[model samples]
Target: MRRLGDLEAEIMDRLWTWDRPATVREIVDDLNRTRPLAYTTVMTVADILHRKGMLRREKSGRAWSYRPACTREAYSAALMRDVLGESPNPGGALAHLVEQLTPEELAALRSALDSVDRGAPGDGPR
Candidate 1:
């Protein structure tokens, strides 16, 4: 998967935080509260995200209302997988990542691994 640009990441953040489909105007207005941005620019980026299959859009009046094609967790997992794929030793990379996790996070990771070992539905191949 491709990495998001700063603006695109910002836009996605808004959509994900809002947890609903949003129009370009809504995104621009929200972003403008922190820094100025053009409506056309948000619209263009939204279009690009849609084409990249990262976003799904529907016609809302004359404008498109956009939402993430996948949940934020899914996106993050994909990014982690991408990074691991780039490593010469994915196992070592994963070990390094696990070492950096807090106790609570380590517990969660262990639980997730347990679920995978138990043949959880969404767990990919063994």
Candidate 2:
């Protein structure tokens, strides 16, 4: 998937944070508090996101309500997968990633790996 533009990322961040479908007006109002943005601009960018399959929208009254097509965690995981795919040695890249993890994160990773090794239900493959 293509990376989002600045405005697109900002809009997506808002949608993810809101955790609910939102109309153009609602997004524009919230964003305008941080930086001046026209409603038309926000609406146009939202339509672009929908076209890119990054957002899903439904008609609400006279307007469209939009929400993320995927959750933030899913999107982040995809980005990480993309980066890993680009490495000359994916295993080494993953090792480098592990080296950088915080203690809590490392513990969580260990627990997940252990679950996978034990063939735990709902854990799936690592």
Candidate 3:
């Protein structure tokens, strides 16, 4: 996984929330909640996600329907690991990251790590 731009993240968010693949018109309508965007822009974002390996697209009734290749949480955690895993000492990098977090965030992160250590993400993100 790699760091995604704002548009790519938003498109991925939509796909994660979706129960099924969505067409260009569906994405355009959903994006309308934030701001007006062109159909082409939405379509382009889907294309970018496909290139990034975040999404799978298929032709359906003269339109392209797109779905996420993995859950957003899985993708996010994979990306986090990819970015942090590159450091010579991931433990040190993780410690530094924890040092920068707010107390409330630290508690949340503690719980999340505890959950992962127990077995799997269980009720949270992978």
On TM-score, the candidate that comes out on top is 2
Which residue ranges in model 2 land beyond 4 Å of their true spot? Answer: 1-4, 85-126
What is the clash count for each candidate, in the order shown?
0, 0, 0
Best candidate, lDDT: 2
Q: What is the TM-score of each candidate against the true structure?
A: 0.63, 0.64, 0.61
Candidate closer to the true structure by lDDT (higher is better), 1 or 2: 2
lDDT of each: 0.81, 0.85, 0.76
Q: 27-83, model 2: which lDDT tens digit per residue?
A: 999989988999998899999999999999999999999999999999889877666
Extract clashing residue pairs from model 3: none
lDDT of 3 at 70: 86
- Kindly give the stretch of ten consecutive residues in candidate 3 with the minimal lDDT sum: 91-100
lDDT (10s digit) by residue, model 1, range 14-51: 89999999999999999999987878888888899899
Model 2 scores worst on lDDT over the 10 consecutive residues at: 91-100
Choose 2 or 3, whichever is better by TM-score.
2
Q: List the residue pairs that clash in candidate 1.
A: none
Clashes of 1: 0
Kindly provide the TM-score of model 2 when superposed on the true structure, using C-alpha atoms. 0.64
